[model samples]
Target chain A: MLIHFHVNGKACAVDAAPDEKLLDTLREKLQITSVKRGCENGDCGACTVLLDGRPVASCIFLTVKARNHSIQTIEAFGEPGHLHPLQEKFRAHGAFQCGFCAPGVTLSAISLLNQNPTPTEEEVRRAISGNLCRCSGYVQIVEAIMDYVEERRAAREEL
Target chain B: MAAMIYPHDSCGVSGATSVFLKVDSDGSAVLYSGLSDVGQGSKTALSQLAAEILGIPMDKITFIAGDTHTTPYDEGTGASRTTFFCGHCVKEACEKARTQLFEAAGRMLGVPSPEKFYIQDGVIYLKTFPECHVSVAEAAHASERIYGHPILASATFSSFSTPADPETGHALMFERHTFGTQIAEVDVDIDTGEIDVLKLAAVHSCGTVINPNLVEGQIYGGVHMGLGQALMEEMLEREDGSVVSNTFSEYHILTAADMPGVMLSGMVERPVEDGPFGAGGMSEGAPSPTAPAVGNAVADALGIRFTSLPLTPERILTALKAKQSSQRS
Candidate 1:
């Protein structure tokens, strides 16, 4: 079967199996490696991707289910030498170790910020709760998200 | 609330490792180490050690790690030994490379002795005449092109230990040791047998801190792992002995939502005599005391001495009911 989806704002069409997961299609067919292959079940959010600007576990999500919807991966955030503010904050706050869960965690946090620009610490924790990070715990991850929120708030105040 | 202490960095596996450093004519340096950074940022920490010794910016240093073909042999990156054992190896290699660069700079400056030179921010200068100096790039170029010597060095480090006695089961183990303490505060419901950890605080002595952020990162991560063992991580099996809780859904680990609202961490730096920059292995110790601290908290809350792990709700409820029956009898 063939599926058409906009990935990172670029229109793409790829052949996928009828029962293929969006995770394998994106990784194998589209060659988007940022969408890591973790627990293929919906439990571990390592395969999370933004579908219509909301985070979803692509591992269990069928490729056919994402035929027309736009998908976003960590590549959409920013390229090398031009990182998103959130990415910069994550680096500064030491939010990750190993970085296997970074893409899903980052997208989840991004989706939360897209809806609520100023999320509380608890809210931030809840946002990336599905994305499990074995390293650094969730302390720095929460700190990074809150720090990004604060920076944006400060910037808006200056405006 | 309860307090507990524990130790980490098992055995002396990290003690046997080596690293290689190469300084190019462009003044950029490359570090090769067998240590792997699974996520704990040991590569960055090792690079920082090299940069500090070489007097170069972090960006100028390219770190290549865990490459079996190109890099030298290493004992691997576990037991929290990368920062201590591999750190010393990187330090030694960088120091040797620094000496070579100083010699080349000394020859270029007509200095009689290389000992009269020192490096600062990638620039080598004469101790007597500070003005007589050259950039690391210039010295490296002169040494490689003119003197026909490429600036490179390698070092191996090992922590001492003796095999256990077969008869007595006694032996000197682990050359270095790290210590830490953790405190956990929890609220337990007697009826529901649910435990909510309100806060967690930790203090550690890991000798000198190579990287504060990475250290904190390790502690936070270690505590999270320990919490899973304390509260809910379990594996089930059938009568035939096949695993049941094999997947993430069945075998649960702590997620972000499970973290305590207040997680505080502190470090106590007491330099090790023979450690690299007075730093020792710090990562393994953080997780050791977390389970004990939490278990103690639950014990204190119910005035019960629990000897087993997880302290699952069913176990708590069973213990409570047994206590009630005993009191009634």
Candidate 2:
């Protein structure tokens, strides 16, 4: 089946099999490989992406279900040369290690920040709980989000 | 020093892990590396190393990571190698670029080399003279104009071992050992045998923390995983080894309401010299310490060293009854 959705701020079209999982459509059809396949049963959020600005596990969603929505993957954030502040903040805080689950986790945090620019530590924890990271204990990832929230708040206060 | 492995050269000092450093015209720096930042703080730690060496504010530096196809071949960001191995490759990449920066500033300043120069606020300055200085972006552009290449550097690190293993597969027993200890405190209901982890203390040695807040995040997250391992989280099988607990309803993980108390501690002794700022290791410290800690803590609370995991209430009660029967003799 043919589907159309806004991806990374651009209009694109792709042919996806009706039974194809969203993860396969994104990785194989669209060729966006940042969202990794950790547990395809939707237990791990490694394949999380923004479906109309809400974070959902791509592995569980049917490719056809995404026909009319806007989806955002990690690539939408920024390229290697030009990075989103959160990506930079994530780096400054060392929120990544072996990075396999990075894209989904980053996108999840970004989705939360977009809705609530200022999130508490617990909020950050709850938001990212589904994304499993077996490295670095999730310390830096949460800290980076917390720091990003504070910085944005400070900037807003100054304004 | 184990070289960089699959993603971040995971072997020795030099590996195929790629750390890309790019400084903008405005003194803002962005680092793009293949390192996975799946919660280990590798992005932040590597950025700190680059920002520290480049003399830029941590906020000014950004990281682009973990897009497997686009990002460098990092070892998939596991086994605590990001900071140790990837950090070195990044450090070297930055150092290699720093040389060109200093060299360019030297010719303009009439110095033999900018060896002792420092990069600050995007400005390159002589450590000794302190008077002669140049903005890194401008100097880099100037260097490009003069030497025909921008101030850019790349490092690809791989774990320094052969993929082919001797029969034992022990040659890579531990590229580097990340040690840790966990202490668990549980409340075992004498009747129900249900164990509640009242509190937990986890001491880790993943090396120097690139970010304390981030490390704390790791602790709590790990504690939750530990909590799941202790009170719940198990796979069920039948007599023929057929799967039984095939769903979340059957095989459960601990939830937030469980309110498992946690204390994060560590023994970083020292960062491996080649590793990121002497930091080494990661979440592998979580599981090992957790089960034992919970088991010991439950014994402390109810006075029984239950031998198996997931000391369910039925098992605990049966064991308690058995212990009492044994004591009666």
What is the Å distance of residue A11 in model 1 from its true position? Answer: 2.3
* Reference-based TM-score of each model: 0.96, 0.65
Candidate 2 residue lDDT tens string, B249-273? 4776653325454445554555654
Badly placed stretches (over 4 Å) of model 2 are A1-159, B1-16, B24-30, B156-172, B239-242, B262-269, B300-303
Error (Å) of candidate 1 at residue B213 is 0.4
Kindly list the per-residue Cα lDDT of model 2 for residues A35-152, writing each as its tens digit.
Answer: 7987788876889999999999998899889887899999888779898999999888766766787898889899998998888877887888777765545656776888989999
Highest-scoring model, TM-score: 1
Model 1 chain A: weakest 10-residue lDDT segment is A78-87
- lDDT at position A83, candidate 1: 91
